[model samples]
Target: MSSRNSHSVLDLQSLTREQVGRIFSIADGYAGSDVSRLATKGCGKTGALLFFEASTRTRLSFETACARLGVHPLRLDGKAGTSLEKGETLEDTVLNVAAMNPDFLVIRCGDDLDLAALSSQVSMPILNAGWGKKGHPTQALLDAYTVRKYLGTCEKQKILIVGDVRHSRVAASHFELAKVLGYEVALCGPAEFLPEKPSVPVFSSLQEGLSWATVAMALRVQLERHETSYSLKDYRAAYGFTVENLKKLSAKALIMHPGPINQGTEMDSEVLQDPRCKVLPQVTSGVLIRQALIQLNCLEETL
Candidate 1:
């Protein structure tokens, strides 16, 4: 553990397998602890959250997590009069905010910006909420937490991650984390949208991948600020997980999505609400996992 100013979660790959295991243990402890006691334990003294991109879940969960720990959360979303609107560079903004000496700074930026470059400019601990198409470490933590909660442990659990790997930060981190946690991982998407030679097996069709997986995690099709001339219907037909395709999953298999789910594009809305779906649990785990992260970082400093 380290002070909020002394730590940064840039990517899941930066964390060792042991550290990931410990994070889960801490998250479990936090999840099981008395809610009333959590605030008094070490609540509001930690730090703030800085997000440079649009977010509903991660931003709010981090704020709630800091509040539970009795720490103040200074939220920085781009708005009128924010330095960002003044055309100031991200480096300058981060440096200026770092000078305020907050306990932690959590950032979600769109460009898949250089995290190490940003980290170098700020002394405060940095956590990547989402960084371009690179990674989302905290999301990976919560995803792992969700899997462990339902499936007992990730060891040897067959997992399939489907959809646009070419543009998903969550997918990339989830794939890497699943592998590190000892799950047999597979990926499926259109040939143009898949990663180049991933460590795990890769498939071009959902039906083919579904045969081998005990869990299927789908990533939403990202339609960011840019509108491409791509065909949504074509993408849906080829890569989307429809109700028919959902039935192909193992009876014991779980369905997951790192959401703002595109109802008719990447997944069927009906499938999202399926009994075997763990999407809601993934959202719940985000708060607890973040709380555990803040607590563990503080504990490290004390040790």
Candidate 2:
């Protein structure tokens, strides 16, 4: 593996499919293992987790992952003295943090921001916790890791990603990585929510995509990112995975959500508890995958 500074894992594009596979393998080892003892491997290193947007899972997962890997975590949420609050540029904030000489930086920002550009300004490895509407590479890695753990492999598996495609970082990241990993990917949502020239197959109806999917990945409706108004009732009637649509899924099909799930909007309330739902497993895989990522990026220069 390259030195952490030589290659930052800000997006899946920077990682080959082989590298990603290796990451999942490492994550697999961490799963169900005594992570507390494992934390000692990264002792003396520090990671800065700066989130410019509101987050629950992504922020907490990264902090927990850092702790489990024995890397001290410095957290900064969407509050006072951040770039926006202080009216300073993101580049400046990152450069300031770089000066502090943290081993790595994990950042989550609005989808509109360019995290890649921000990474370019820092010498230490930068891990994109989540980036505005464009990417959530780590989440994609964990999601893929979860799928592989349950289904044996990801190659050629049909995955239908539903909802808020135009604004979801997770959807964008998953779409890019899944295509690279040879998963048959399809998008389902309203025309406004779907991208005009998406690389993957775009379905007008959720039922059509669901029927073809081996994995139904539901994305939360990102109202915060919406430009125009949307009706909840209408959205649920059309795009949401209603109880009726839930029954349409194959018994073998797996269900997943990136979470902070808007129950009754993108999915039915009961679907959260469904036997086939792998939501909790996705959360578990997230911590392990992030730990693996931190371990890889926090390696000493001599190593």
Candidate 3:
């Protein structure tokens, strides 16, 4: 939003090409043995992790990033030990957290809260962990980093994101970021699952999508977010990514997933074991990108 040392990464759409490059550059510096060396920079800083929804990968990686940087990660998982469930509004909880003056806050909010409104009320920097059904900017950053790490460049690369396109923040963020990052992204899913009028190409069949993509990112079906019901049997039969589906992918094509996967629905569990699958690699990249975010936002002056 503002210059370095004063801004929030609300969404990837708001990030500039140069800004994206800077984030990637910072992540590259901590890509390997350099992780433990940056502890001094974040020695006393504290970053708050305010997660309102259930999470596995995102939450843990952010915590791990803060630890690696030597920043104390104070966590308040939705209503667990906090007064949130006893009727304290998310906005009020955030305002209360802000009053304590943490260096930065990594928030994962539910659909009801207006993050932008709450963000305006805070003094500390805010990083959007997950943005309703709109976008997951940090996830996009990590995914982009993984792509660069694997393919050496993102320019003109093809990534076909398969399954549950309608409710996936991951797909929305990546598709939007593609415009600035110089890559082509396609969406493939059941008719109800796909967006009604996506700017990018859409495919109904997974096989057809894999034929054109160098990266196949299978998205988890968001039953929690869906307003209408659909048949899992029918959906899986048509769009499930399995080892058998891997044959359609080119030798160099990468397979990815934003995890906590629906074992037999979005993809078969066995597909995760494939050598070309980069889901775990994506998780590893997530930590480094978050470390970069922490440095840029929490340890701003040192950079």
Candidate 4:
């Protein structure tokens, strides 16, 4: 496996299906073990996690995964000094951090910024934590990992990703990866919420979409990214996965959300506790996949 500067994970679209499968192959072992098994593998190395957007699971889990691999984590949130607070450029600030010589850089590019350009200016490996509404490769990895963990495989599985397709990094990453990974994927939401030129089948009716899904993944309605006004009440009535509405899906259908869910908007609050809900498992999958990613990119030690 390539380490350091050579293996930057900017997005899933760049990786071959074999490369993605290898990541999960490494992750499978980590799932059965813990920090104690490989605690010192990444010792003497460091990783910088710089998020320009608000995050909870993605940031915290990457930090945890770094610890499990014995890689020291340096965190930077969306707080002061991360901005043009002193008129410094984003590239300049990132370059300054690269000078510190961390093993890799994990970054979340906000405001639709170009991560590829930023990565080109740096030498160390760059891991994209999330890139605005463009991509969330790791999230897609974990989500697929979660599905594989429960269902044995993701091949030929029908994943109906519903809501906010036009402005969801998760949805963007999932569909791009799905094409190569062999999962059948589609989109469901209001016309405005869906992409104008969709790569998959688009559905405006939630119940109809739910009927065909083996994995029902709901994306959060990103009001922060929306420029025009929309009605939450109308959104809930149309796209929301309520207790009554979800019964229309197959009992075997797995439910998921990327978190910070808008409860009554995209999904019912009670559904979070549903038996079929794989939300928490996705969190667990995040740690395993991330640990594997760190090990592959930062350490030369054999797994």
Cα lDDT listed for each candidate: 0.78, 0.82, 0.85, 0.85
Q: What does candidate 3's lDDT look like per residue over 1-303, in tens digits?
A: 323324777777777788889889988888855665877878888988999988889999999999888999989887888887699988889889988988888999867878777777787788889978878988988998899989998889999988888888888789779988999999888788888888889876788889999999888888766788988888777788877776889989888888878989888888888877888899999999998988886687533
Worst 10 residues of 1 by lDDT: 294-303
Residue-wise C-alpha lDDT for candidate 4, range 219-243, written one tens digit per residue: 8898877888899998888788889
Q: Candidate 1 at 22: error in angstroms?
A: 1.7
Cα error, candidate 1, residue 278 (Å): 0.6
Please list the residue runs of candidate 1 whose C-alpha ends up more than 4 Å from where it truly belongs after superposition: 1-6, 43-46, 223-228
Instruction: Give TM per candidate.
Output: 0.91, 0.94, 0.94, 0.94
What lDDT, from 0 to 1, does candidate 2 have? 0.82
Tens digits of per-residue lDDT for model 1 on 93-197?
777887887777788887745777877776667788888878888987898888889888888888888877778888778777876787777888866567766
Clashing pairs in 2: 39-69, 39-70, 110-132, 111-132, 111-133
The regions of model 3 sitting more than 4 angstroms off are 1-5, 301-303
Pairs of residues clashing in candidate 4 = none
lDDT, candidate 3, at 297: 69
